[model samples]
Target: MDNFYLLLYLSVAMFIGSFVAGLVPLAFNMSEGRTRLLSTFGAGLLVGTALSVIVPEGVEALYIVHTEKYLPGAVQNKDRNQIISNSLIQPVASNLAAKINYPTYFGNSVVGKGVVEQMQQSPVMDKKETDEYRHSEASVNFNAINQSIGYSLVFGFLFMFLIDQISKYLSSKDGDRTHLKLTATVGLVVHAAADGVAFGSASATNRAGVQFIVFLAIMLHKAPAAFGLVSFLLVEGIERFRIRRHLIIFSVAAPVAAMVTYYLIVVVENDKSSTDSATGTLMLFSAGTFLYVATVHILPELLGSNVKDYQLVNSATEGSSRGYSESRASLKLIELISVIVGAISPIF
Candidate 1:
């Protein structure tokens, strides 16, 4: 409940910050290079959050879910054969096999490669192979869970990829690009809602810092998107009133989505273990989207600009070439360092 309140406060701050960013275009000029630099930093932050915080924590949460399910009152049940069989026993069998050269422990066995090969040639090899086929139930369960996580990650990535393709197709059409701008604005709003979902999922965890880190990354990216959206609209000769209307809608979208998502997760998950499992799945899914946005969308934009700068340097007269190249190198260095700093910030 307290986490929800914190989310509320963050949402309000997000709205205000986005609104202010939207208004920036009306007040002053913003340079292209500066915007890209800021975006580069935000992209790096996303990369770090997805890999360092979200993925690891998510895997941990899922492992806990399995532990709670399979090993309830593990200490009390340690001596019970049925209970021990349901728990993690593959590692134990393997260890015993390594130490004792044992072939079977109640149909659970681990054998050396040479032994397996020799058994393969014997008349009873078929029986041994059948026995080997059966593995610890807990191992199978963990394997299935890991596979589900991988699928979720891929699904999230592909979902974002489709969105990006649709957005690109819309913006690529020739002339009367008002619709292009509108499409882009919708995409940003959708991205914001996804950010809200990430925050909501993280908040379901016991770690407050995880939720806060996700929120920080969302804000870092959201501010630039808001500002860039308005700036683009103004350049397209959009009316101030219409632009404000769009900005308001964009600002409100995230907080609303966040509140609704958090409420739904809390209400639907009746138990701690279930809630943690759901949170883990969502976090991994969010990490995939974050990877898409950071690596596929934002970071690659630098390539085009870097090429343009290279051409400009090549075309410059000999007299100014050295100075221009030095300036460009310095700028590149700064952007690289900014990204590094942003990537490391969320970890601490």
Candidate 2:
């Protein structure tokens, strides 16, 4: 199937999945234990996808771009010869003949031909010339492109951090949690757009299974995120209509961004190398954001103290210490296993 059509299908799936996930909070009262498990699992999926899929895929795409760009071929060999004849050998020989008053001797019609011929025939002259030239050219590009990738990753991470901090600040200042919820929702919407960019880039690559895997990883986390967002808004006493509006906005963000980004990338006619480079940069940036969301936003909630669990433990009978400790240990074990499984799932 065409990548455009494939992306369309995945975008629609994401839209519906997210919308339904948001509605889940309104439909059911989710248990604290179940919510934690889902969140932990989603965090693990983000970690697995970023480290195992997006980061490595981005690096490989760039590597392929440069490798193809610099590969020595018949055309490159011909160009190399012309460059050596016109630039390197001719300049030196012409100067030498002119200084010695032998213009005719080293002119284009005379010793210049002999000089070029001799250099071309020498075994050592062009033996590894193509390899060296390719290396030099590739090195400059690789360094610059690598820097771009690094900067993009850092930018993504910092962007999310700033969003998180702003939400926290607003939440601290306001007595009502509504503003904080809205701010956080905005952050998630932006992140959803970033995920769309990743999806679009993967589609641009036209690689089998690449876009599918990215879509799967995205949906896995996005569902839980959408659910959590609606739940938070509800807990903050936001009106049902307002919650629906937020859900709709969040649900549409990724699909619209995915279609727009994919169209922009696919419609513009550019060289394959440039497309690959762009795709790689976007993928790495998405990976960085994924890392931030997984580590800073999601995983910490699981690893840190739980107010619900603390309350439960406090309310337990004094004689239930052994059973309480054993149950706590079991819950910890379950959390660990869930995370490990989630982290490893993307590899398959």
Global lDDT scores for all candidate models = 0.71, 0.71
Please list the Cα RMSD from the true structure of every candidate, rounded to 1 decimal place.
12.5, 9.3
Which is the leading candidate under TM-score? 2
Residues 163-204 of candidate 2 have per-residue lDDT tens digits of: 666555655676655556667677678778877887887777
Tens digit of per-residue lDDT, candidate 1, span 24-66 = 9889977767776787788889999998999998899899988
In TM-score terms, candidate 1 sits at 0.74
Q: Which stretches of candidate 2 lie over 4 Å from their true place?
A: 73-125, 176-178, 307-331
Instruction: Note the clash tally of each candidate.
Output: 0, 0
